[model samples]
Target chain A: MKRSERLVDMTKYLMERPHTLISLPFFAQRYGAAKSSISEDLAILKHTLAGNQDGILETVAGAAGGVRYIPYLGKEHAENYLEDLAVRVQDPKRILPGNFVYLSDILGNPQDLRQIGKLIATRYAYAKVDTVMTIETKGIALAQAVARYLNVPFVTARKRSKVTEGATVSVNYISSSLDRVSKMELPTRALPKGSNVLIVDDFMKGGGTLTGMQELVHEFEGSITGICVLCEADFDKEKLVSDYLSLIKIDQINQQEKVISSKPGNFLTETDFSRF
Target chain B: MKRSERLVDMTKYLMERPHTLISLPFFAQRYGAAKSSISEDLAILKHTLAGNQDGILETVAGAAGGVRYIPYLGKEHAENYLEDLAVRVQDPKRILPGNFVYLSDILGNPQDLRQIGKLIATRYAYAKVDTVMTIETKGIALAQAVARYLNVPFVTARKRSKVTEGATVSVNYISSSLDRVSKMELPTRALPKGSNVLIVDDFMKGGGTLTGMQELVHEFEGSITGICVLCEADFDKEKLVSDYLSLIKIDQINQQEKVISSKPGNFLTETDFSRF
Candidate 1:
């Protein structure tokens, strides 16, 4: 293939499999081009990605090393995405009957999920996460998104038992929203013991659900690498867990006044983005 | 930017926003290049995508015209993926005591989900789907995968009610394994009326759960665009619904005898890949 054609295919191939090592010989064989040409094509890709500040292509020095693509967004890109996301979360029309914010729109949005996932993945790009964990229903999307970027499998904990799962390990935590004890469970074989796990959820109300996930992680003998939530309800009385990060914090939800206030949470400051 | 750089950015931009239309002039202005240059860049991208048969750079003419990136996979890609998937699923260790297949690995694997999602998305790329729907538990992963590629929000129907979702629409489904009627529900606002929804599941034993999803779609006055499953148990009883696609089919599984057989299902044959 010509250099231009090889560059097009090489860019697409690397982007699809981020953080994966690819050898020049493999690309040469795939493109039927010389290793020198393949190397040159990669240099162009690396320069293009670096110039855009949207991605990174790292070159490895040895026979086993060639190039690795990292799906990254520069500081400006991250800030712009969070600011727009916070604004969208602040829409008053999202307020539901019992003061619940209707965030299904954001949760379902592909672009939003992509940024959120990449942001979280960027935070843990070096964490060496074995698995991503989240509770059922709402947290599934956030968990799956982060897991995708990290190239790891995400395990979901369910509140109820299903025969389909075969066997499960259950954990109980205080449900502050309902003022009762709630139980969540994970399939027995979902996570290998002693593996590193990153916990994620859509909303953190008093952090009760997060604690449940923590307990479940402990049961599996896996240590919690980190915990993050898309939204945190600051107006709620008392939190069940700390040392967690939120992308957006909802400080006030005054249904009577039809008001809501939010901003990008501590995720930015909490994240160690100095890896690159 | 030169055509080389423009081609790289255009590929990334179009791939990131699948199924969305982008005008040629928009790119022309973004690159500070002439319309003719932008057109050449798009042609390169379209040709690259077409040659691989991995995606389609759809061009629409007239006043509302530009290009759309459609996620697609070739027959060989689908066959190779599903064949390997079937072999993995046939592992005796994956066979649970109650004839259940341990699919947690597949559900958690990002690589597998990406391929599966892209393949299913290709089938319905032109179907104008408004949403993707699935039942709780394993089906969540499949639904999210397809939804991610389709660039649509996926709604999960819970087997039981949770306090988070406030109000819901419930439907009755025959629990084939339990041989009893069971109920499933989705949030009242999860699906808007008149949506064209594609239903997906992790496994289909008797297609009972899919029927329930169809019923919920009916209650909302929405239409079922299509139905698909990751695995279908051909050895099981006749299905409750027809017109569904399965990525893999388990023809036999006798735990006591320690035997299993499977292959890719009818999806490859039934899907219309004429667009590429």
Candidate 2:
């Protein structure tokens, strides 16, 4: 293949499989090009991605050296996205009953999911995240998006057990929003012991569900590398978990007044975008 | 930017926003190049994607002209993937109690989701699929995967409604597996009226859940563009719905003998790969 053709295919291939190592010989054989030629093609790809600040191509030097694509966003890009997302969240029409903000539309949008996923994946890019864990329903999309970029499996915890999943390990935690105990379970085989897990959710109200997931990870003898939520109810009464990051923080949602206010969460300050 | 850098960024940009058009002038402006140069870069990308049979770059002519990337797979690639997937499904260890196969691992896998998403998107690439819908829990990941490829929003039909979602429209269907009438719902604001929806799910026994989703779509005054499932139990009782495609068909699952048998479904034969 010609250099131009090889560059197009290489960019698509690496973007599809982020955080995966692809040896020079593999590319050389795929394109039927010399090793030196392949190296030059990769240099172009790496440079272009770095210039765009949306992706990264890492060159590992050694006997097993290869190029790995990392789904990352520059600090400026992250800030702009969060700012726009926060503004969108400020729509008063999104206010739901009991001070809950309706965010299912944003959660369901592919473009929004892509940006959110990349942002979360960028934060945990260097962390030892063997598996991405989330509770059932809304959190599944966020978890899958992050896992796709991280090149890892994501497991969902269900509030109710299903026979299809076989054996499961259950955990109970306070449902702070409702002020009641709720149980969640993960399939016994879904996650392996001693794995490093990154917990994610769509919303955090007092961090009850987050705590439940944390305990479930412990049940499998796994360590919690990080906790992240798409939105956090900052005005909610005391949180159950503190070591967590949120992309958007909802400071107020006045159902009676039909008003909502939010801003970019601590994720902006907590994340180090200097990895490149 | 040089031609090489333009090609790299153009490929990445088009791949990120599948099914969305990018005008020549847009690329020309982004890369600080001439319109003719942008067209040449897109041509290289289109040819490479076609040769590989993994993606399609549709070029529009005259005024309002641009290029659109379509996530597609060749017949051979789809066949090989399904065959390999069927063989993997035959593992006796995957058989759970009550003859249910454990497929959470596959659903949780990023690589598997990408292949599955692309395959399903390839089938509906030409259809007017305005939205992708799936029942909650296991299907969210699959729904999001397909939605990402199709550049459409996906809405989940919940077994139970939540206050955060606002109003909902509920439907009742016979749960053939449980042999009981079950209810499912979708938030009123989740899907708009008169949408072209493509329904997807992780598994299908008698396809009760799919039927429920079909009804929910109808309630929204929308049309069903297509229905696709990742796996179907061929040995199960008569299906509730007939117009659907499955990637894998499980012919048998003997819990006592710990034996399972499966094969690729009608997807290969049903899909037309000559669109290119």
Candidate 3:
């Protein structure tokens, strides 16, 4: 293959398996190129990603050295995307009954999912997340997107038990939005003990569902490294959890006036874009 | 940017948005290159993908001239993956009390989802599918994966409606497995009338859920393009739907003996790999 063809194929291969180590010799053998030639090809791929601030290619040195692609969006890119996303969220037609914002359309969208995934992947580029976790229905898409970018498995917490999943581990937490106790479960066979988990959700009104997920993660002998939500209903009366990050913060949703107020969340300022 | 850098960026850009057309002028502006230069970049990409039999780059000429990336996997790739998947599914440990095989691990896997998506996309690459549909819970991931490759919106049929989704279209069908009438619904805004929908699911015992989803699609004045399942249980005495494809077929699951028999299904034979 020519250098140009190799470069295109190499980029796709690395992007599909982020945070994975690929030895130089393996690439040489796969492409039938010399080791030195493979190294030069990678140099171009890494330099291009770094130049755009969308990704990082770490070239490990030593007897066990290789290249690892880290999905890290530059600070400027993250800010730009969040700003655009926030503006999109400000549409008045998205408002729903009881102060709930209708976001199913965006969540079901593949393009939006890609952008959201790349942004979330930026935050956890170095967190060493073993798995991405989310509770069922609304949160599954977010989890899947992040997992794809992070190149890890994502487990979904279920509200009801299903025969297809076999044995399960159950947990209960207060749903602050409804002021009632809610239960969620994970397939006992899904996550192994002592795994590092990143919890994500589509919407966080009072952080109730997120807390339930946190408890479930802990019960499995896993650690909750971080928590993030696509949208946080700031107008909600009370919050059940803190120390969380949101991509877009909904400060107000005026149903009578058909208006909404939102902006980029603390994610932009909190993330360490300097990893490059 | 040099040709090498351009190829790397183009691959990433096109991979991120599969099956969506990007005008030549858009790429030219993004890369600060001329239209002729952009055409060369796409030529290299299309040629590389064709040689690998991993993707298709459809070009539209004339005033709306552009390129679109179609995620495609050849027949050999499908057979190899499904055969390997079948061997893994034969593990007796996956059998549960009611003869249900545990497959949450595969469903939640990113690598598995990517391959499954490519294989299904190859079958329907020319089907003119406007949307991919699946019933909620376990099937969402499969639907999203296929939709991502096809560059279409995925709509989930919910067993119960939520206030956040606004209005919905509901349908009733006989749950063959449970032998009872069951209801399913799709949000009114999820799909457009006169659209072509490709239905997908994670598992199929009697395909009762699929029938319900098909009915809901019809209620919206849409047509069912095709039906696909990740796994189909042949042990079921009767099936409610036909003309469906399965990635793997579970021939048997004996709970008493803790045995499972599975193999690649008719998907491989039914699909036409000659498109490449």
Candidate 4:
């Protein structure tokens, strides 16, 4: 293939498989080009991605050297997205009964998920996350998105046991929002032993569900590398878990007054965007 | 930017926002290049994607015209993937109690989800699907994957009502697997009226859950564009629903014998790959 054609195909291939290394010989054989030419094409790809501040192409040097695409977004991009997300969360129409803010629409949106996933993956690009874990229903999407960017598998925990999944390990945690004890379970074979897990969720009220997931990870002998959520109820009761990250923090949600207020969470300040 | 850099950036940009039209003027302004140069750059991208039969760059004419990227795979590509998926499904260890096969690993895999999502999107690329719908738990990942490729929002139907989602529309259908009437609900604001929804699920036995989703679509005053599933049990009893596409068909699973059999479904014969 010609250089221009190779560049287009190469960019699409690398973007699809982020955090994966592709050896020079493999690209050379695929494009029927010389190793030196493949290196030059990669140089162009690296420079363009860096110039755009949307992704990073890391070149590993050694006998096992190759190129790895890291989904790294610039600070400006992350800040602008969080600002827009916070504004969107502040819509009065989203106020629900009992001070709950309706965010299902945002959670279901693909563009928003892509941005959110990219932002979260940027934070843990170097954290060595073996797998992304989330609970049933809402958190699955976020988990899948982050897993895609990180090039890893994701596992979901279920609240109710089902016969389809075979054997499962159950964990009980306080349902802080409901003021009751609830149980969540994960399939025995879903996760491997000693895996590094990154927990994610759509909404966190008292961090009960997050706690449940953490316990499940422990049961599997996996370590919790990080915890993140799309939205956190900052004004609610005390949280069970600290040291977690959130994209948006809801300060107030007046149901009768039909008002809501929110701001970007600590994810912005906690994340280091200087790599771009 | 040079032609090589422009090609790389343009390919990445278009791939990120599938099914969304981007006019030449927009690309010209973003790259600070002439309109003719932008057109040439897109031409290179279109040709490269076509050569690989991986994607389709469609051009619109006249005013309000631009280019849209359709995630498409050739017939051979789809066939090869499904064949490999069937072989993977044939693993004897996946056989579980009650003749059920464990597939959470495949469902949770990002790479497998990407291929499944792209194949399904190819089938519905021109179907004008307004939204993707699936039941809670297992189907959420498949729904999100397809929705992302189609650039549409996905809605999940919960098995039980939750206070977090506010008001919901409930539907009752016979659970073929359990042989009991079960209820599923979707938030009132989750889906809009008059949408063309594509229902998807992770597994189908009697297809009772799919029927419930179909009924829910009707209840919302929307149309059912199509139904797709990742796996279906062929040796099971009569199905409650037909006219659906499945990626893999499990013919039999004997837990005691440690045997499982499967093959590609009708999706391959149903899809037309000539567009590439």
Candidate 5:
């Protein structure tokens, strides 16, 4: 193939398999091009991605060395997207009963998920995340999006057990929203033992749900690499977990006044973007 | 930017926003190049995608003209993936009590989701799908995958009502597995009226869950563009719905013998890949 054609295919291939190492010889064989020429094509891809500031193509130097595409959005891109997302979150129409902000629209949106996923994946890009875990219903989208970019499998925890999942390990946590204890469980075989898990959810009210996931990870004999939520209710009474990151923070939701206020969460500051 | 850089960025840009059009002038301005140069870049990208048969770069002509990256996998790719998937499905270890097959591993896999999403997207690439819908829990991953490729929003139908989702429109369907009448619903504001929706799910036994989603779509005054499931049990007594596509067919599940059999479904024969 020609250099132009090789560059286009290479970009698509790498983008699809983020955080995956591709050997130079593999590319060379795929394109039927010389190793030196393959190197030149990769250089163009790496330089193009770096110039756009939306992706990174890291080159590993050794016998096993190859290019790995890291879905790292630049700091500026992160700030702009989060700010816009926060503004969208401030819409008064999103206010639900009992101070719950409706985020189904954002969670269901592909464009939003892409950015949110990339942003979260960028934060944990360097972390040893063997699996992405989320509680089912809403958090599945966010978890899948992040998993797509990180090139890792994502498992969903369910509030109720189903016949399809065989056996499960359950965990109980305080349901702050309902003021009761709620149980969530994961399939026993869904996650491997001693795996590093990144917990994610759509919303956090007092961080109860997050703790449930943390405990479930422990039940599987796995470690929690990090925890992140798409939205956090900042005004909610004392949180159950503190070492977590959120993309958007909902500071206020006035029921009677029909008003809402939000801002970008700690994900902007807590994430280390210096590697790019 | 040079032609090489433009091709790389253009490929990534179009791949990210599938089914969306980008005018020549937009690319021209973004790359600081002439319209003719941008046209040439798109041609190279188009030819490359066409050659691979895994994607389609559709070009529109005249005043409102641009390119659309359609995530269409070729017939061979579809056949190969589904065959390998069927083999994996035949694993006796995947059999659960009540003759249910364990697919949590495949559903959680990013690679499998990517292939499944592209295959379904390929089938519905030319359809007018306003949104993708699925029943909650397992189907969310499949819905999200297809929605990402189609660049549309996906809404989940819940088995039980939740406070997070505002008001919901509920429907009753026969749960063949439990042999009981079950209810499922979607939030009132989740899907807009008069949408052309594509329904997807992870598994189908007697097609009960799919029909429930179909009814929910109708309740929202939306039209069903297409219905698809990742796996369908052929041994089931009868199906509730007839007009649907499945990627894999589970022929038998012998609980006593601990044996399972599967094969590719109707997707390969039903889809039209002649456009390429």
Candidate 6:
């Protein structure tokens, strides 16, 4: 293939498989080009990605050296997206009963998920996250998005036991929103032992669910690398878990008055945006 | 920027926002290039993608016209992937109690999810899928994957009502495994009326869950575009839904003997992969 054609195809191939290394010889063979030419093509890809400040093409030097695409967003892009997301979260229509803010729309959005995924992956790009973990239903999307960007698998913990999952390890945590003890479980083989897990969720009330996931990681003999949520109910009761990050923070939600207020969370300030 | 750099950035940009139109002027301004130069760059992308038969750079005419990147895979690529997937699914270790096969590992895998998502998206690329729908727990990942490729939001139908979702519309379907009727519900605002929804799931024993999703879609006054599943239990009893596609077909799963067998499903034959 010509250099132009190779560049286009190479860019697409690398972007799809983030954090995966592709040897120069493999690209040379695929494009039927010389190794030196393949190196030149990669140089162009690396320079362009760095110029855009949203991605990086890391070159590994050694016998098994290759290029790895790292999905990341600049500080300006992260700040703008989270600020806009916070504003969108403030819509009065999203206020549900009992101070719960409806966020299914945002959780379901693909564009938002992509941005959120890149942001979270950026934080843990070098944290050695073996897998992303989240509770069933709502948190699955966030977990999958981050897992995709990090090029890792994600496991979901179920709220109820099902027959299809074979055997499971259950954990009980306080459901602060419902004010009751709730149980969550993960399949016995879903997560491997000693895996570095990054726990994520769609929403956090008092960090009860986060604690549940943290406990589940402990049960699996895995270490908790980090904890993150799409939204944290900052105005709610005291939190049970600390040392976490959130994309947005809900400060208030008036059900009777049909009003909601939020702003970007600690994720913005906590994240090291100096890399890009 | 040079044409090489422009091509790299443009490819990454278009791939990130599939099915969304980007006008020529927008690319021109972003790259600080002429409209004609932007057109040439897109033409190069279109030609390369067409040659690979894995993507399409569709151009629209007139004042509102632009370009769209449709994520697709060739017939050969689909066949190879499904065949390999079938081999992976036939592992004896995956056989569980009650003749169930353990596939949480594959479902949780990001690479497998990407291929499955692209293949399903290829099938329904032009089907006018307004939204993707799936039941809670296992199917959420598949739903999210397909939704991401189609650039559409996905809604998960919960087995039980949650306070966060507010009002919901419920439906009942037979739980073939349990031989009992079960209820599933989606929030009233989860899916808009008259949407063309594509239902997806991780596994289909008797397709009872799929039927429930179909009923939910109908309850919302939306049309069923199609139904797809990652695996279909062919050795089980009669299927509840006939018009569906599956990537892998499980022919047998003898729990006591610890043997499992599977092969590619009708999805390969059913898909019209003639469009490159």
Q: How close is every model to the real structure, measured as TM-score?
A: 0.96, 0.99, 0.97, 0.99, 0.99, 0.98
Task: Give candidate 6 regions above 4 Å deviation.
Answer: none
Q: By DockQ, who's the top model here? A: 2
Q: How good is chain A of candidate 2, measured by TM-score?
A: 0.99
Tens-digit lDDT track of model 2 for A56-155 = 8999999899989999999999999999999999999898887788888898999998999999999999899999999988899999999999999999
RMSD in order of candidates: 1.8, 0.9, 1.4, 0.9, 0.9, 1.1
**Residue A108 local lDDT, model 1:** 72
lDDT by residue (B151-224, candidate 3, tens digit) is 88898888876767777789998877678998888878779998999999998999898999888888999999
lDDT string, candidate 4, B6-27, tens digits: 9999999999999999998898
Cα TM-score of candidate 6: 0.98
> Positional deviation of A242 in candidate 1, in angstroms?
2.1
How big a share of the true inter-chain contacts is recovered in candidate 2?
A: 0.94
What C-alpha lDDT does candidate 3 achieve relative to the native structure?
A: 0.89
Candidate 4, residues A1-276, lDDT tens digits: the string is 999999999999999899999999999999999999999999999999999899999999987999999999999999999999999999998887767788878878999989999999999999979999999888888999999999899999988878888888999999898889999999899999999999999989999999999999999999999999999999989999998999999998888878789999999999999997
Spell out the clash pairs found in candidate 5: none
Give the Cα lDDT of each candidate: 0.85, 0.92, 0.89, 0.92, 0.92, 0.92
DockQ for all models: 0.57, 0.88, 0.77, 0.82, 0.87, 0.82
Can you give the lDDT of residue B263 in candidate 2? 98
Ranking by DockQ: 2, 5, 6, 4, 3, 1
lDDT for B238 (candidate 6): 95
Ten residues in sequence with the least summed lDDT for candidate 6 chain A: A96-105
Tens digits of per-residue lDDT for model 5 on A1-276? Answer: 999999999999999899999999999999999999999998988888888788889999899999999999989999999999999999988898988888888999999999999999999999999999999878999999999999999999998867678888998998888889999999898999999999999999888889999999999889999999999999979999989999999999998898899999999999988876
Task: List pairs with backbone clashes in candidate 1.
Answer: none
